[model samples]
Target chain A: MKQKIRIGSGAGFSGDRIEPALILAEKGELDYLVLECLAERTIALAQKEKLANPELGYDPLLEKRLIGLLPLLARKKIRLITNMGAANPIAAAKKVREMLVKAGLNLKIATVTGDDVLEKLDLNELSLEGNKAIKNYPEIISANAYLGHEGILEALQNEAQIIITGRVADPSLFLAPMIHEFGWDTQNFDLLGKGTVIGHLMECAGQITGGYFADPLKKPVPGMETLGHPFADIFPDGKAIISKVNGTGGVVNLQTVKEQLLYEVINPFQYLTPDVAADFTTVKLHDLQNDRVEIRDGTGNKRPETLKVSIGYLAYFKGEGEISYAGTGAFERAKLAEEIIVKRIGNQFSEFRTDLLGINSLHKSTFGQDTIPYEIRLRVAGKARSIEDAKLIGEEVEALYTNGPAAGGGVIKRASEIIGIVSVLMNRKKINTQVTYL
Target chain B: MKLLEIAHSRAGDKGNISTLSLIPYEEKNYQLLCEKVSIEKVAAHLKNIANGKIERFELPHISSLLFVCHDALETGVTTSLALDSHGKTLSSALLEMEI
Candidate 1:
């Protein structure tokens, strides 16, 4: 058994900086460089792209990121794992194969599919938020179940250098590599949970580091401009140490790790994933020297019987317009503009919102009315059935330029289609995972 | 003193629920955080924007408190018409609350 293996995070999201990943590939001695680029709605967007062109369902930055890391990966013999395939893994794998061949690098690549369960799923069987039926929305663009580590482990076991997947769990991308290397059993819930905690911490790339840990003078992190990405050193026992690259500008302490541990998590005792039900409440973190923090004692119960499926549907057309007002009575003028808009195009839009940007936009009704601001931007947005109907909301707001509000400047208007998401639970037995190598 | 004086926070959204983790710089402040930052106080503080039930989880090992505010994002990120769809700035907004 290996004593320890290092896995570095390349990119956190789809559009994350690629240069930091190259730095890891070149300098950081890593067994695997995992890039978690898929977000909840990203695959849905990719599905739309796939509809336009069958060969373009993967992440837009896939080519750019590979162009930067392929050479270093080949040199270092570092394996690459990513969920950047989005809605299409085969096309992404093909693209990577073409890139590698062009560079004359004989690297093995694998793609995992079967997460796209749209066709197999019955809308009647699915429910969203207590009794809400999926059948109500007929415009579903994409439906994908969150796959576990089985497919990823299968790919690794086949000696694939690069593993690309679609709609796998974020932590699974990191955990699969650990499971394959350590020869860990799939049914070992405790080890799986422990490994998952490591994956979760390192999944956000720089969150465990200091990218999202800065607060100017309050909690200052050095080298904010070129923040370092995070990596984990996993031991045979499943305990791991989370740290960043040497000479990189980011802190890995209890505070940063703790903040990230609870990020996007609901119940501390039950962080549900396909592999394990991880209990992070008892997890401990010790700050070691050189920006390393040892994380231990992550326990788990049996895995959930069902998997969560993210379903994206065409919601409606959104029309938005923003116009700024300045000087003494700016708030009043913005309010007047909102009232005028409601009077003009209120019935046209199915649902709409008007906000005074500088005033009570974010924390609405939280702060009591006080002193009037020098400037206020009136933003009115609405959703309609059609693009032409949605455009009217923006048009009505633009009419305020000549129709009402005094000194309305910087008028910006836009109309676009909105994607709506619904979550449903699917039985684990229903979904099947497939792995293919190229 | 304000919450920002002693603690730092990060907020993230999953569907309509938004979770904010408040981690104190000093371990001693964990007790103070538990005392001052209650579910009621948090719900009251964000009463305007967050209209759902508030649940708090204590992670004493890490000296942090997590607040999960349901129905907080106006709606989900993809569906919400709000300016800050992900509610990323809610952590800073919550930090502004005086203790």
Candidate 2:
């Protein structure tokens, strides 16, 4: 009899840096371990690296993390799936193999690619649909598709304990085994969509369980140190429970599960998928027992005729400077200082763009939040299309220390310029994903 | 068959929405959607049944539609949907998406 398994990937904050998540599979107790090391900025970071090294689009930091765990995974022999490879899975796989060989651990790794149709695409032919206010750029920095769990199935078939991929749609890491184990077919679109929805719920590991959804009211899941990974227990009949590493501090109850289910769905029922669109809105969330929720009623739907392309490029050459203005009129003074400096900087180097971000959304997002009155600091940043333009803009902001306004004002303290970037805007399309698997 | 189901899902911590994956219409039915069906009719039907204010997102590339019933988020249930009061149309609605 095929046994049911529950596995969760590991992710935690260690002081100033984040530790790798794949380590949870090393416990010798998990069927699958998911790692989410890539974010929007991380995508841009990989693109920046590719500019320096043509074949280095995949983030090396994530690769370094994955490589470090090979020996432990091999020793324990755990099967896995991950989207650590940002753009090119093959290139990323080579790096992983190199790391494995260096560490004296031999492991089979597979790459899933062909998700990025951004470069060869013509934006004129695509539609933003109802989503407006989004801008499109002339060039693409990085474009990749969301390959579903098919890669994991192939890896398991080849006895590969670890599967590395460019950008497998997040849900497939959790759904692959279920499909393979249940003998579900590609034509079984409805069930496949359900499994995909289940995978989507657990992919974020912590976000769905309790890490992000813990109500601000209750004494939420405490002691996040040694946070547990997320896993699912799927039955042959088509229902599952999402859980995390045992004894891990988190709850997988109704609120948590529903939150996960809703994450990233622009629409509840017509949720698009590479394999099949899932009717997530129709689904039911049942608190089956302790720390468990049963999600049902999701009907499989058709995927969008277009694939979403996440494009990135240069925003400009940007520089940042931070400073403090204490006492009675600190906020007002800071606001004025920002406006004057921006206008002055614009006057100084008219060819660039200036963006000023303060701690309002960061420090505290809502009312009733109290920031120290006298400690308010005014920070300024400038970005331009050209390096010289950016430099001139930077010089303009720095000029505040000398001839600019607030130079000798009370608490006109500190500042510095930051590096700028050329921002890339992405457009999406729906086409039959073409792949020649080797 | 062309169908769109609009509902919300979580993206991260705060409630971000999710897209419900619906089965799409077929090859020969392309011209029929624009000529026969109207976005207003679908939006009206969904708005009447759903709980919260219906949020609608239209599409491009194809002449299809995405009608989301935005008002359902407040009900606080594991699963929720507002079925149209006219019960005879469900089979036709499923046929629209070709489910």
Candidate 3:
């Protein structure tokens, strides 16, 4: 049995920095590099793309990322895992195969499916608002349940070098490798929970490695321009050391790890994942020498009986317009512009919002009547039922330059459809994972 | 003193709920933070942006306090009209609180 396994985080999201991933793959001396790319809304967008082109539902950067990492990965014998197969794992695996063939490198690829439970779901059985059935909304685009580590462990058992999955729990990507390498039992909830905590900490990549933990003098990090990615050294006992690659920029300390440990978490005592109900209240972090933090004692209970499913639907068309004003009572001019735009489009769109930037845009209730600034930007945004109606908001804001507010410049407008997300609980037996190797 | 002097924070969002973690840089300040950073003070400080219920969880082992503010991200990330729909900047805003 291996004493320890090192797993590096390549990408936190779909659009994360690629250079850091390259550095990790080349120099991190990692056994596995996991890239978590899918967000709650990404799958819905991918599903929309798939509706247009049947073979194009994965992440757009999948091909480029594979091309950049394949040669090094093949030479180093390092395994890769990712959820970049946003809506289509099969098609994504095929694309990876094509890239490998062109590079003349031989590597086994495994794709995990069965997360997409749209067809099997009963909308009438699910509720959105209080007692409101999902069937009432006729515009759901995609629905995928969060899978566990069983499929990923199966892929590793098949000796697949690269594993692709759709909508698996983010922590499962890291936990599966540990379970595979250490031969841990599937029912070991405490160890799974411990591994899940590590996955949650490292899933965001730079966030836990001083990328997001930087302040001017309070918490300054060196080499912010070239922040390094994070990696974890896990042992058979479920304890691990979190650190970054050698000669990297970011700092790994107890603060960074603690902040990430509770990031997006509601109740620390009950962090429910598909594999285990992990508890973070008792997890301990010790600051070691040379930017390493040792994490230990993460406890867990049995996994939840039902898995959480992310459902995305076509919400509405959003229209936004911005106009700036500067010098000689700019706040008054921006306020006038806001009033004018609202007067022109307010009756048409009830969901409209107008803000005087640099003033009460972000925290309006507290800073609403604060001191006026010398310069301000007027922004008007609203949701409309149709694109044409949404475009009217921007048109009115642009018209303020010539007709309403004097010295109004830098008019910008945008209109796009918004995707809405909702969550539902599904029985574990309803969703069955299958793996395809190439 | 400013909260940033002794603690650092990171914010995350799930649907309309936004969570921010406040971890003390020195273990000695954890008790000070627990006493000064009350849910009422947080709600009062952030009364402008987040008008929802705020729940605080204490993790003494890590010397951190996690605050989960419900309905805090306007209408959530995908549908919110704000430039930062995920409420990522809320951490900085929370750091501006005085203790």
Candidate 4:
């Protein structure tokens, strides 16, 4: 049996930086490198692209990422796992196969599918968000149920070096490797829970490596521009050490790990995934003092019978326009511009909002700051039923340069259809998962 | 004293809910954070952005506090018209609270 296995995180979200991932594949002596690229709203956008072209639904950066890492991944014999398959895994795997052939590098690839459950969905089912029936939503785009590590594990067991999946739980992308390496039993909830904790910590790539934890003077980080990604060295007992590449820009300490522990998490006691109800509260962290932290004591119970499905539908069109004002009474001019735009097209859309960017735009609450800024930007946004109606908002704001506010410069306008995403629970047995090798 | 002096935070969003983690710079200040930072106080501080139920989860081992606010992101990021739809800045806003 191997003493330990090292796993490095490549990408956190869909648009994360690509250079740091290359650094991991080259320097980090990793057995497995997992790139978690999908976010909650990512697949929904991919679905729109798929509707336009059958083979274009996968992540746009799939080719770029593979082009850069395939040589190193092959040379290092490091297995790659990712949900870059977004809305379509088959096409993504095919693209990777083509790249492998062109580069004269022979690598096994596996594609996992069947997460899409639109036809299997019952319109009468209530959404977990607002308790509204699925039928009430119009223009449904896609519905993908979050799968577990079973699919990826099957591919790994089959000796597939590259595993591509659609809409699997983010942490499962990292957890599957542990199960495959250690030959862990499916029913071992405690081990699975500990593995899940490791997955959660490494899933966000740079977040735990001090990308989001930096502050000037208070919490100073050395290299903001070249922040390195993190990796976990896991033992057979499921205990792991979190660390980053040596001489890297970021720091992996107790605070960064603690912040990431509760990120997007409501209750630390029970963090529900498809594999296990992992308990984060029971987990413990130890700062090793040199960009390394030993984490242990993770536990969990059984997995849930139901799976969470993300449902995407067309909600409304949003239009926005912005113009800047500077020097001597700039705030007053911006306020006047907001008033003029609100009076012209305020009653047209269902929701209209006007704000001065330097003022109360971010937190709509009034804290009453002591000083007033000499420069401000007027922003007007509204939601409408049709694209044409939404365009009117920007057009009116543009008219201000010629008619309403004085010295209104740098006018910008945007109008796009908003895709509203919600979630619903589905029986795990109802969704069938399949894996195919390329 | 401002909460920023003792603690730092990061914001995350799921659906219409916003989750923030407040971790003290020193473990000794964890008790002070627990005493001063309450769900009611947090809801009052962010009354403009979030109006739904507020719940706090404690991780004494790590000496951190997590606050979950529902109906927070103005109907979530996909549909919300707010400039900061994901409520990413809400973490800094929460740090402005006086202790």
Q: Which candidate leads the pack in DockQ?
A: 4
Model 3 agreement with the true structure over A166-221: per-residue lDDT tens digits? 99999999999999999988898999889999999999999998888888788888
Q: How close is every model to the real structure, measured as TM-score?
A: 0.97, 0.69, 0.97, 0.99
Q: What is the TM-score of chain A in candidate 4?
A: 0.98
The residue-level lDDT of candidate 1 at A115 comes to 96
A303-408 per-residue lDDT for model 4 (tens digits): 9999999999999999999999999988888988988888889999999999888788998754656466877888999999999999999899899989967899
lDDT of each: 0.89, 0.52, 0.89, 0.92
Candidate 3 scores an fnat of 0.79
Return the DockQ of model 1.
0.79
Q: How would you encode candidate 2's per-residue C-alpha lDDT over B1-99 as one tens digit per residue?
A: 233222112222111121222222342343444444444554443432233443444332222233344433322111111111112223223223311
Residues A1-438 of candidate 2 have per-residue lDDT tens digits of 355665565542111123324435644266666665554435555666777887787756655566556666776666656666666566677777777788887777766666665556544443232132223543345555555666577766776666666655666667777777778776676887778777777766776657765533432665466555566777765577766555666677765665456554566556665667877655666677666777665668655544445444443454445555556766665676678776666554423332223334121121233564664555544434556655554454555566644532432222222211121223234433333223
Best by TM-score: 4
Report the lDDT tens digits of candidate 1 across residue range A1-438: 788999999899998988889888888899999999999999999999999999999999999999979988999999999998999999999999999999989899999999999987788865564356788875989999999999989999999999999999999999998999899888999999999999999889988888888777977889877888988889989999888888888788888898899999999899999999999998998989788899999888899999999999898899999999999888888888888888888777778898888777787753444677788898999988999988987788888888877899989999999888888999989999999999
Angstrom error at residue B73, model 4: 1.0
DockQ of each: 0.79, 0.08, 0.73, 0.86
**Sort order, DockQ high to low:** 4, 1, 3, 2
Query: Which of the two, 1 or 2, has more DockQ?
Result: 1
Provide all candidates' interface root-mean-square deviations: 1.2, 16.5, 1.6, 1.0
Per-residue lDDT value at A45 in model 2 = 58
